[model samples]
Target: MQKIIVGVLVATFSVNVLAWGQLGHRVTGAIAQQHLTAQAQAVVTALLPNEDLAEASTYPDEMRSSPEEFWQKEAGPFHYVTVPEGQTYAQVGAPEQGDGISALKMFTATMKDSKASQADKQLALRFIVHIIGDLHQPLHAGNGTDRGGNDVKVNFFWQDSNLHRVWDSELLGQRELSYTEWTARLNRKISQQDISAWSDIDPQVWVSESVKIRDEIYPQEEKISWDYLYNHLPQVQERLKMGGIRIATYLNALFK
Candidate 1:
């Protein structure tokens, strides 16, 4: 019975473990690229001569399928931070294996270390871009229950899904827009004031914002459809925009 129960729980929560789908991450990256300071842009161009931020934004998730030990076992926790109900991230701290907050610190140090190898800096840069996008997805800052809502089954647009997937991809996917199209539309909505307000580079602040959003987004019913989309789409857009802005702000400060 114990084995059976464990298997069932694993199956229930394993689907769609990624935070933002490919398109969403790309959208955040593109937006960030547009916002980058000239120095940051020059450094990014030197580091990623072949790929743009949009392409780099998806590298960590794309590598999740690698047979290597780092991707297979070690890198999983870097994608999210767990904050249980009524508890702050400061109160809970990172687990033994570490989490998104620790990963950000590690990679940020790598980016700044003058002696770090180019390849190592490149890897860190890729993760920084990707992880910033991940932290923006409310579900990535899990509530320490339900595997970030993966266990809460639902029907998204009449198709079987879960609360995590709904926030991770389905909400953004429903619009059928390419990442560039999404970036174009979202960029227009960002005002100077919005940029100023969302420029904070602290990962903890991002996690806190995500946890607050995560708390309010759980569905009241298992049948999620247009109403859910209509209600939460703005929040989704806001997060993506903020993610992009912060990524730029962070890199600018780092490269400065």
Candidate 2:
């Protein structure tokens, strides 16, 4: 009975929800690349061949513009998991086709698969890098309502924007930092214990953390400006930092 309920909830799962815009993904990617182990860096280099981890971070998102049926179907649902307000990913049950949580698990498995083709592994690595960054952007773990804040329209500096878009690029974009600069600004010496703790955390756990942020981020009014930015900017940077650190953790584990 419990299994049937979970299956039913999973069936209605949505996919390819919006994520951190290009610059944000790159920021996290750069951070992760900086922290990778020598062994992991070697494997990532071999897998990507021409692209560095930071450069490859946006591939999954870039592919969204492709018209291929395979990409349209297979790559869609992995971008996010809708946890809904007041509920957790596990409590709501993940879709069988997979959300970010399931996709992260699957993509990591593909990365470790000796039988997987180089192209396939490369694709997996890109998706893995993108998804970890996505999972950190509070909005990526959408609530069952509001389409992950996409439907929640608001004004940024008197310009129209949605809540998700604010987090995706607008908020992060406010800093006007290049990806490299963002990486440099956010670079911190993660304590050994913090690295150990963050590296192996489950995707479901990421969703839970994101959901908490999502809930708290709802603006008191429709207009957001520097005051809002001033307050939440640190929170945003922290997410980026965690995204980078955790991403390195995932890569290090895969290549180790």
Candidate 3:
């Protein structure tokens, strides 16, 4: 009976995540490319045997939320990758904080955790790629509420959606392109310097940058209409392009 309930919850969360285009997963793929060094890229490229692509997806929860009602204690790998209290990713957490300064810290810890099995590490690496991408999106940092923009409702291209959903898919998914197609479309024209600059991995810097752009991306009004999105397509595309490149940069660092 306990197992059955756990399976049902996992199914629900998976559906919610997928309905959002698995934005975090898509970004992970982009970041994996960004972070892979040339040599690592070659390795990953080869690793991309058809089987690999077919099997790629985010990890499922190892242990479901227990206590029947403790949603906050569910403790997925994502929980550790988020911002801690009071301090932004740019500033170091107080000395008592356990390497809570950046998502990368969590990434490194999970990679080295004795408790995590080999499969867990693989899952961690995938999410590390994804979480890095998540960190880059300003709204994901949020202002201590709304689970980023997940709570902020709006109309995206005539569909009812929230600001978080818009950032998750409305923008990136608009082109209806595959990962390669989307990456190729955006990759050709970025200047080398710009790529180098955007690739910086400082969590504080990423957070700060996201906060600054947050307002521009999401206006205060709740019912953002089609005109709003149309007006912001350029901005939307820029974020997606940046997201793809920065993801590659972070992933490259890992393999290097």
Candidate 4:
């Protein structure tokens, strides 16, 4: 089975190590940047003058290779959460290692701190931008047994890959779209009412959303192909769209 989309690829950094991969995150960033309010946009520009959300979206994932202690240790859990099959994220609660929900709250506060240095705030903003996007991919809030599907191996379009890799990049990468093209392709209609409907900055709520979709992401067969792709591609699109809208919502509220 396989899925669908439009456009050519723009090369980026390592894809296998991150949630939603590079293109997905950049698409979320591009959509979020477009929807940001004037005040929010000003704040974003102030922090990451050269890079908009599209470019800044991949910063955290890129840091996976960093020799810095913070990136090596503190940033891993911030990229995903583990909400088991039946229980809600609340019942299980985030562990002491910290999760996307808590990490996001931490980053949000850092960005909002007036006493925080420009360097610190910039770093926090990038983290927030990236993590919010990460939390939307259903596999990020994994079922706990499969290491977010990393252990669940499969052949995607005849290549060796796992469930997590399929969702992260295989699907998006197969589209052959640049981040800008992916952004434009996924940036759907966002009316004022739609914006109002999309509000709610809680990361826990975001986790719940992921859990619901996570249920639909799997197949009984390890040999998934085109049919499997067609069924779940819509979920990928929806998640990316929601990720962008919600990121913009949080930043707008934060800066407003």
Candidate 5:
């Protein structure tokens, strides 16, 4: 049954953990190298190990019986996951907010489930961590239909892919920078208060914030391709930076 859904989902639109890693490398780099609380730094560090794993851990089938079931697995050590919509927190029992909130909830739940296998819980935790950052991305939250624009086909700087996939991996990976190199460039301009104040917050707020950003992302057009890229790459980078900083803030609160 799970396989069926995954298959269907894959057919409709497929996003793997590698997508997360590619985005995270840039986002995480932006989060680190900034002055933050020790707790926040630690949370970012914990997420660091899982960064590259996003490349291979696209195993949503193993996590739960359905998308809702996947939400139930939200516990902690890491805090976020890509939850399918139409499922509530009470129904799913995981983190109830957006990617970060949902991921955080899953992370907390995994820590409490002694009956769960270590590997199962850890995989869940890794997603929780990764997804929080994903949620902060306005495009990841999407426009309530395309699973965050994954289905919105377009030519991203001439590459043929959907907007969601473009945002998921292509744009960030385009420059061929390591996670550290990307963050280094971003962190240079961050202020001390931005680092301190950005730490410690709820993921729900982040989700709401992204939803607002979503409207600005998509215009009423059949295609959002290279032309859109020329116009919006700056917005794209800004959102990625926002996601990284916001993710660092949420994790700091959790660990602290």
Candidate 6:
């Protein structure tokens, strides 16, 4: 029983480390779905007949509990990349086991391969949706020092939490909005200029942007509250919007 409890805790921590929380992922997916070209939308429909991208976006993280080796081992590192301060991802490069950008490139090739099995394509599409969102979460582009801020403990609104969890969910949760509501609110703020600027699908550009934001986000105080939220929410919202646009841009290019 004690072993089982420990396993559960480990599994939970692994999941927490790998995602943008369900709401954030779903919001990005929904926004992406809206921006997808008709051809891309048709392809997505063929690949995922029953579920929307929002549902599909959470697939990788949701599978973290699986006993399979792929989920248990290989896939965890696909959610984030680490670049030490002052170094670019190009300088650090992907670890031999691979990182988010490497996994994304592999999956994208699978998605574009006409001979690939439907199961494989489905996995690729879901992962593409997810990794785009994951890369947008600034912490996912860790500084290679603090486990993406998971080690930085803080009291968030008097609740014991770490900086990673606060960024991953707590700050967004404070809005009291569902994923769709968040999507709706964010989508309105996206303009043609914003879309044009964010439409670049280069993962390196995404990582660089994230690394810059990640550096700026570390909190000074151990106690976090409205001031923190008020300061960072714009960055959070912008990242989500960019993630969504880039997902659409990528898929539209893929299926075009």
Best by lDDT: 6
What number of clashing residue pairs does each candidate have, in the order they appear?
0, 3, 15, 6, 22, 0
lDDT of predicted model 3? 0.53
Badly placed stretches (over 4 Å) of model 3 are 1-20, 31-35, 42-87, 90-103, 110-117
Please give each candidate's TM-score.
0.94, 0.90, 0.68, 0.91, 0.63, 0.94
Q: Residue-wise lDDT of candidate 5 within 34-56, one digit each (tens)?
A: 53467655544454444433232
Q: Tell me the tens digit of each residue's lDDT in model 6 across 1-256.
A: 8557534433443456856699999999999999999999999999899999999999998898899999987788788887889999999888766789999999999987889999999999999999999899999998766778888999999999999998888889999999999999999999999999998899999999999999998888999898999999888999999999999999999999
lDDT of 2 by residue, 88-184 (tens): 7778766665678888888888887889999989988999999999899998887756767877889998999988889888888887888888888
Clashing pairs in 6: none
Candidate 4 structure quality by residue, lDDT tens digits, 18-120: 8888889999999999999999999899888888888888998887889898876667777887787999998987766677888888988898788999998
Ranking by lDDT: 6, 1, 4, 2, 3, 5
User: After TM-score superposition, what is the CA distance of residue 32 in candidate 4 from its true location, in Å?
Assistant: 0.3
Q: lDDT per prediction?
A: 0.88, 0.81, 0.53, 0.82, 0.52, 0.89
- 103: Cα error in model 3, Å: 5.1
Query: Which prediction has more favorable TM-score, 3 or 5?
Result: 3
lDDT head-to-head 4 vs 6, winner: 6
Q: What is the lDDT of candidate 2?
A: 0.81
Off by over 4 Å in 5: 1-26, 33-36, 39-100, 109-125, 219-227
**TM-score rank order:** 1, 6, 4, 2, 3, 5
Can you give the lDDT of residue 220 in candidate 6? Answer: 88
